[model samples]
Target: MPEASFSRGAHHPPTATASTAAASTAAAARGPDGPGAGLLGSLAPLLAEWLPRQRWFAGKGRPVTGFALVSATEILPSPPGGTTPGLLHLLIRAQQPEPPGHRHGFGCGHRRGAAASDCYQILLGVRTTLPPSLAPALIGRPSGGPLDGRTVYEALADPRLASILLERLRVPGRLDPLRFVREPSSAIPSILPPRLMTAEQSNSSVVYGDTFILKLFRRVSPGTNPDLELPLALARTGCTRVPAPAAWFEAAPPPEGPGPRPEPFTLGVLQPYLAGSTDGWQLALDALAVRADFTDAAHALGHATAEVHLAMADALPVSVLRRPQIEHLAAAMSERLDSAAAAVPALQPYRGALHAAYEDVAALGRTGRTWAAQRIHGDLHLGQALLTAERQWSLIDFEGEPSRPLAERRRPQPPVRDIAGMLRSFDYAAAVGGHDTPQDWAGGMRAAYCAGYAEASGTDPRDEPELLRAHETDKAVYEVLYEARHRPDWLPVPMTAIRRLAAAVR
Candidate 1:
């Protein structure tokens, strides 16, 4: 994938708005549907045709399963183009996941020339109600979004959707295939599978074949997303470890354009298409199989990550470090987890373990630098992290996890969530890489990673080991809930982890 931060494209002509206004008003005055749904429906078919071309659309090449407008509101077109109004609408369907969702609502940018088209922008809802089985893995709130047609977020916070989003990427996030029998295709067939990929779940990423990633938004705060923010900062750091951002397209909401716009932005992101790089989980196992040099690689990755974070704080306004909060932040987390856990059956079995884990996390949450908050890879894991030929680790999918609400993903939790994520990755790496042979190798790799991070970040985890351990444990319980729903086969991975955490406490 090409880097999003560096755009080499030449300038093009600006958009037009005259036709957009004429079309919207004409349709409204034309009574929404003159002949079929009439002119409006005429436009729907046009949009249906264009949707598959979109980076966000799931089944582009295949036939559009269906197109129906849930709601529509008119908004003024971008300025310079004048008062041309366009429809801001929500489009839904039965997509691959059986529940079939939205192709998303679009505010088609001013339709020009002979088309007399009415469109200007798009605002997508980041949250979706899923089956109970898949709910536990979807944790966190959306970090930023375009909800009810608006940009969301104002700070350097974690994405609420992280938990669920990450879980959905696991291998078995699919629903019972037998439930939703295959349907007929209008054009060809739906190439979009029922299973959602991480890149697809977060950013609208697609390929000719093999992989597609979707980006989800919620919270609808106000600012460019970090997926758009951090890569630019990292580019300045000139780090080779991260994936070259391929291509990223934001909903690109018009600000103070010629009119009153409702929808916020469109989904856009394209990448070079990483074909053969080993997944971090696979690489971790591979590395462990060899020498004990995992520490050196870990140190380099630490500096790379630290460098990105530090640079982000300096460059982007939102990347500025979050303010200090109460030392008892863990108390708040425990409370949230306790409440959420009750609602999640998968987490219920380990309720007592959760409470104990919470106490430890609450204790640790008290000691870390309460003010050290900054934009983090909200859902860090062996899966979220990938490897590059430069022998560097790259991070992808910044939309956080989709299952979360937008608000929480935007909250500032301890940076330790990210730290714990890396540790977990190492654990997973050791588990899978060693042919399912349990080994203490993960510990050694984790120690090396910590040392590297501490060496450069000047962080002192030993001072807060208990606190870190507590956080790690709480996170582990959360993982049990995650894998259980998204990848039932992988449930044992986290179940064992929860047991380990509980035993440690005992």
Candidate 2:
């Protein structure tokens, strides 16, 4: 999914009084057999069956053994009149039954019997009758219990409810555990129609009349989300290459075992929407289709990337990767390479060379030459970039790779890692455009990008050849596994890179 893409719209009368009463009634029936049983106990079986079917669910191959409710709140009560459509915001913990010895590839960190669970954010629209427009988003009707015979569907798919959500965000207030906080300088209008962006894989978005876009994160983790954090930091550094954050919503997780404390988990973010902007992925494909020289665009994108990196370095904490940290990074890459080789048979042939690429980086670290590290766009690709109508590049999606742990994604890393990601994206475009056999166009674009980065940041990525090669190789290994699992037809794209890199190593 393009990082900046995807959202829903209407205004209901002031129904706070009616909503409060409805909320009270719903809360009162939260037992095993009451009208709210579906919200508590009965929703698990339904979610277990439904979640696996979602494209965003990461635990597709694993069986969901049980569900633990992290928190549940009635964000909106049944609208005025006799119509009963309540919007409920939920944070659910899905328990996965562990296989004896399974290790997921691409640094997913999935291990047997190790907290085998994932947290998901679900916005459910509950109603007695299914609307024809919303029938596609239907989760399923409960067989029995509090919500028996009632339909529950993804609420973000409903434009009316999505507009209501926008109004709620426009007014800064706390809804118990859920708090809507707006940027102090934001000037968003109160009534903009909303439209759902349907191309997203890991999140739901609502675009508000081309004014702002709200992204509701699907899988959530504790602490401030980097998607919000990084953009805010970049804005503070006076970086116009990223859209400024307008508003965000977060909820305090319910207390856990003894002495539970309140820690906020970011649920969604609102940012100024760039209407008519084209994503870099599509832009590259278009350029490739016509065999247009993409060197200028690639160079401009590199400058934008370097600008963001410089801004991040100025706004966030920076560190030097000493021997131990460098070794650890190399080790992690080696581990991912091993896991990818095990998962993709095509990668096995190149494992030795890939292992050597990681070793070369480790050997460089042993030479006592420390590299600068700072927060970066950890999972940068063409899809994460946007070219505005002004023909300028803008970066998005600082949440990093979804598979890695939040702490790991937030950790400082060499900027070349991002540079390597973009280079790989260029290769992907070339391959998909039928130019992989001669890769000269992609190679020229890559060199131009590095030149632009050096011109902007005063540090040529090519100066660190070993580190760059290793990072690129690591990213390709990850692609091999990802494509093998999710997109088997695209497996050859990364396999080409693997073969070329292996030949170079030999």
Candidate 3:
């Protein structure tokens, strides 16, 4: 598979002419009841080979068994002149075998873990011939079916088609199953140039004239995505700690599906871009490179996080995790540890010690202790936080961990989970920055961050050492498995944390 390209092609005449007979043929091939109706039948052969190689594809190491097209829309018709490519928006479900020992059920009224089927939002550019510039975005030519002999490539790679998406979001309306929603009174420019963000992310992002950034979720699930849901909630509370959604889009689930019908699936969200802002991950690394004290920045970030949490609590429902809930949380962590240890042998030696951490949580629950639970930035880390030039911290990407089931990602949880995730991130920065005494630097920053959080929220995470430790342990266990699978060279970074966490447990 070619590397995902961000190259842009010059704009051409958006209008073209084609014979009526030819147009009918193209429509028939792409139409649902057309002779070449089963689009996936032709595309599956190519997608099965190409999808797994993508950086955003979640089901790595699993073979794609098959694909089914949930919906397809011809955003643009193929021009007989062939000066520009036609755009096709597709929501295709890729089916794969369930991983061994996978047991998490989709609590959102869907069957899961029996078989792995993920719906992906794809934009394909169809043309009679491919351009040299778009060679990298090519998905390959279909040998049969309606798209037979036509070149299919990633559409977002083309600037002309990328602009069409923004045009859709500029107006609030529905195109059959796909809905384009614009926030009331939100004015979007008509001709902002779109350029694909070249970052390797779980989803694709396009920056429009440095004015707005639209995140297109690659792997989609039914129901409101927390990335949009949380920010919208915070926006209601007048919170400046998160960027509000300017516009967004989603797909209405089919009314009569084979299994459970789910809520609308959020496909993309557009938010005002914070120009001249840097992400916290790069900011930390830059600080580390110069041996600069990052305690001040970390403190500010913690304060920002507390503010967001407070706003979230104010805008959304909050609950208390009693003994049963606490016990369940501990059990879930233990199960993850077991799964991770089985996948990564390096975790085995520390298994007993790590298990002790979760047990402590259960013990506290057994003593009738309770903790506050609310919706939070599920996958909080340095990378997810953005720092403006004015030193203000704005949190982004509330979609949580992509690898987890959608139900799990959306579930309410203790804010300490976010705190723990940030704490682990400091360790990652220390390790990657090559600091002589990485732990000392990370430890001090962590203390400062907690101090700031305490000052803002009127509660110190350190006061509940057991709860904090357990979450941190769970995070490190997750990191170990992730690194082992994706980046073997980075395994030691998390392994060191695991060793420290395990030793602390003992």
CA-lDDT, candidates in order: 0.44, 0.79, 0.83
lDDT of 1: 0.44
> Candidate 3: global Cα-lDDT?
0.83
Ranking by lDDT: 3, 2, 1
Per-model tally of clashing residue pairs? 57, 10, 0
All candidates: TM-score: 0.55, 0.90, 0.91
Residue 96 lDDT in candidate 1? 17
- Model 3 — TM-score against the truth? 0.91
Tens-place lDDT per residue, model 2, 5-107, is 0000001111112112122222332433333433444465677678888878877888776555556678877643337688888877666655434565433
Model 2 collision count: 10
Q: Give the Cα-based TM-score of candidate 2 against the true structure.
A: 0.90
Candidate 1 lDDT at 339 equals 52
Q: Write the per-residue lDDT of candidate 1 for residues 375-403, one digit (tens) a residue.
A: 66677777766666556667766555433
Ranking 1 against 2 by lDDT, winner: 2
